[model samples]
Target: MRPPNTPPARAVSTPAADDTPAADDTEFRTLLDRLSDKATADYYNPFTTFDWPASIPTDELWMSPELLSCHGTELMDELSPAQLRTLSRWESVNFYSLNVHGIRELLIEVTRRVHTPGFELPSEFFHHFIGEENDHMWFFATFCLKYAGKIYPDRSVKLPEAPRDPDIENFLVFARILIFEQIVDHYNVQMAADRRLHPTVRHINRLHHQDESRHIAFGCRLVRLLWERLLDRGPDEAARHELRGHLGGYLGRYLTTSIESLYNPAVYRDAGLPDGFALRKRLLVHPARQAAHAKVLHKTTGFLQRIGVFDARH
Candidate 1:
């Protein structure tokens, strides 16, 4: 079943020659082709890429302390080192679980659109996109299963239904992809660099970030191309307005849900906290946490606003 508020799966019409991407859009097609080539060359077997120790070392942290669920708050200070370590490992599992589920949804979106009536050259890159996403899902799920005993269930963001116009629908899907990659990349880089973490954990973060860097670059360029088309093509003011509202609120809700995943009852319970949900509420509302959330989302939100796709006041 489709999760609440998550974007509905799109159904694309059979491709036709007339619907091939415009010849004049050479730059966009060329860029995607170039990126696709890079992905192929950079491919690695996630299963064998990391030296997964027979057992993950419990002495080391799994994530950067600063990126912890309760970082910068009184709740964070309340934890002993042992409790903090447990939280770090569980939270790392939660993070990877989100990536696994997010990639699952992304695969659905791109699989349907690639080679459809409206896609042609870009379909070429969609092949790379889909391939890379599959690898990502595998590594993330594998890590969770091997180290955490179970993968965290998807409770991140709930997307709304798809938009009526294909242009708007495409825009939103790519935008969501961009949002997800950027946020996850933040954790990847931070954890990858933290020497206190296990080698396998660091390798996982580093490897994923390397791939995600390309993904994020492609996402930015693709969104820009789509935005230019929106400017020149259809979707009247009313439609644009509605999409803008959706983008703003969708991102707002996405950020909220992503952060809330940190406060999962399991993380707290594992960390030895008696009442997980109560502490979660308090941490979420903390002044420091609020600021941190805004900071985490700042760059991507700014980019969307600059492109005129997101209107916060709308």
Candidate 2:
């Protein structure tokens, strides 16, 4: 909305007067040790992580039925338990396929920064972040390929990358990263703890959650740090307006698209539903489905609202 290259105010970082070297170093080491140690013990090779089951059992539900897009609707209830199991398998495949796609996009952005200058302090943790994300992509893709024979391709049209003032670019990037993590985390935490899902299905979710917990923590802190620095460089009128608009519009699109992306017609077609695309379209606007989406994003939405990233109207 604003013209590009708005000049920024002088930078002002958070206070550090009481923070002596010993105290600061102690806290930094604690976080570093936590991530490094987790990588040592919790790391997995996608090639051998799970004894890939010969097949998804027909009788056992592969995903919690309640988590489905059509869940709680008359349509879902109409299906027999056997049919529900079929849907569960298809839904799980679709869900993990999404994880793979999202991981790929974020990895590209993270990789670009990890190797560049100015990331020295956090460089060690970035190694763990990159490695964990790579492993996640592998395991998620493995499940879909093994069970569904293919990962669902992303259908969203790629929009041209938006231009941002260099001063606030880092804030926007980390904000995007944090929102993405928080949204998916809604599912990862639930499914990881959901005993109803198959062992292999739950294991992958559990592993992903374990690694993502660290990423989410790091993202939250980093976003706040960047946000404070951006605020310190007092923005011009145009920059201030653009920042507000970006927060609202960016959050709106993130929440809406993240939910919409889950509805792949192929998933319905595989479950033997006729007119899969039509059903997907119908379910997208369904009230119950919309409510389910709200549930998924409740924590994330609340967090953003608290941080002023999303306003009351949002």
Candidate 3:
């Protein structure tokens, strides 16, 4: 087990290179083009991908307690044996609910890119992105709707606008989107390996996980190139600081989004936890969950710091 308080493994910083990345940029674009070509032919329509006629088993647990965010006082050593099982079930549903909501928003953003001027190339990847996220949203909703009879709506987690300049909005959006995708990708990978999950849940996760590997690859390459491209253009120090601040807040939100508002903590109140809000606080700060939080956030954080977006001394 990872020791408590030991910082999670994260990438260290490197000085920003001050040269043009024309060759590297071309190489990255070529790779994305190849992925677009492959996706154009190989993409599966989400509508036909799954057999939705099967009934979801309501009693089946979708998440393990170990996977739940650590902030709940009723978790781990604090829970009664019976409550532990319920906690596991709640966490699973909570996880799926967040996916349903987040994917919906991301799909909205991606769909806007399709067939638009200046985004024609990215529109190819968006086709694949929409296809994958639509399937993801469907199965997650299918489980919730079939078993629970409703899908949860988005929680209130609106982030403050990051520094705005026409010059930096493109870079900022690239960073923001990448940060969100990386966190989701972490959960997808982890859940795919969890044997306690029901078969249908596992099948959905495995398929989503398989597709996200490519999305992450594309996002990572694009974000890196975008950052490099921006840095080469030489923003002022104030702009750099604003970008870092935005990234930090975005990172924190990405890490804590599910823990903060995804579940009706009131469910815990019904489950014999003192009150729902207290349970929310407990889980939000739990060491194990926090570690998992850091694990996901690190993908984007580490990349940013290494690429000179979040310098330590600043």
Candidate 4:
């Protein structure tokens, strides 16, 4: 009945303000404090993380073919070999473009919260986070611009729009973003260690992988705390049901991408392919992508399983 922005009539509940972390939402505040301490102790100079003295190999493949497009064959197995190669190159561009765009968006989100009134504790570490992501965005774009020649514009995946329910919206955003980063982290970690990659490329991944480990730690801690608080609100059964429904929808709907849809099928038409949508459909369920999904989704899957959000799928 009151205005939507009004605080809950009752005091918002909080996790036990202790300084330890746990899986089942016990001692969350305590856990966050410990996480903050770790970030401080483990801080590094981003500029020095990679030695720029190293030259890069322009002809070397930055990505593997299994990670590349099958000329829409996964969905539209009707392409010529030439078309598949074009699809492969475009898929590479698309992957790096998403990284470029997604990191920028995350930078904005963290920046807004970093200096805001209620965000002090988390923002302290986010200061480091923003710096690290800035470096990541630079390196991702560096490769895209230097090699691919142009960064692709962002694709439409309008995720932030939510229903009228505030609790439902907040929970959904956290869950979706958590899943997104978890998937990308798998690639970053692998490329970081791949000796075949140019030093710059490997350095980029190594730096990002290091920072992401911390980001995941912080994100998991924050989401678990937030989830506990949401469940404890003195809501009627219907409101609680709606919240749970929102969580389930996010859990199921947004965990993975359809790789086939990644490179525009027009790309195939230009390259002389028969149909775009069919090819996209084929690629979406390709074994390589499924493996990519499994690798990136591992941590999120574990988190969700522990939280009882999804039946254990692994």
Ranking of candidates on lDDT, top first? 1, 2, 3, 4
TM-score of 3: 0.79
lDDT string, candidate 1, 169-236, tens digits: 77767777887888888888888898998888888888889888988888887777777666656469
Return the TM-score for each candidate structure. 0.88, 0.85, 0.79, 0.73
In angstroms, give how far residue 218 of model 4 lies from its true place: 0.6
Of candidate 1, the 10-residue stretch with the lowest lDDT total is 1-10
Superposition error at 303 for model 1 (Å):
0.9
Error of 3 at 110 (Å): 2.1
Candidate ranking (TM-score, best to worst): 1, 2, 3, 4
Which RMSD values do the candidates have, in order? 3.3, 5.0, 7.7, 6.1
Candidate 3 RMSD to the real structure: 7.7
Reference-based lDDT, each prediction: 0.75, 0.72, 0.61, 0.59
Q: Give the TM-score comparing model 4 with the true structure, all chains together.
A: 0.73
lDDT of 4 by residue, 31-140 (tens): 55666677678777665654564334434555544445552234335544444555555555666677787777666555644645434445566776677678777877
Q: What is the lDDT of residue 216 in candidate 2?
A: 83
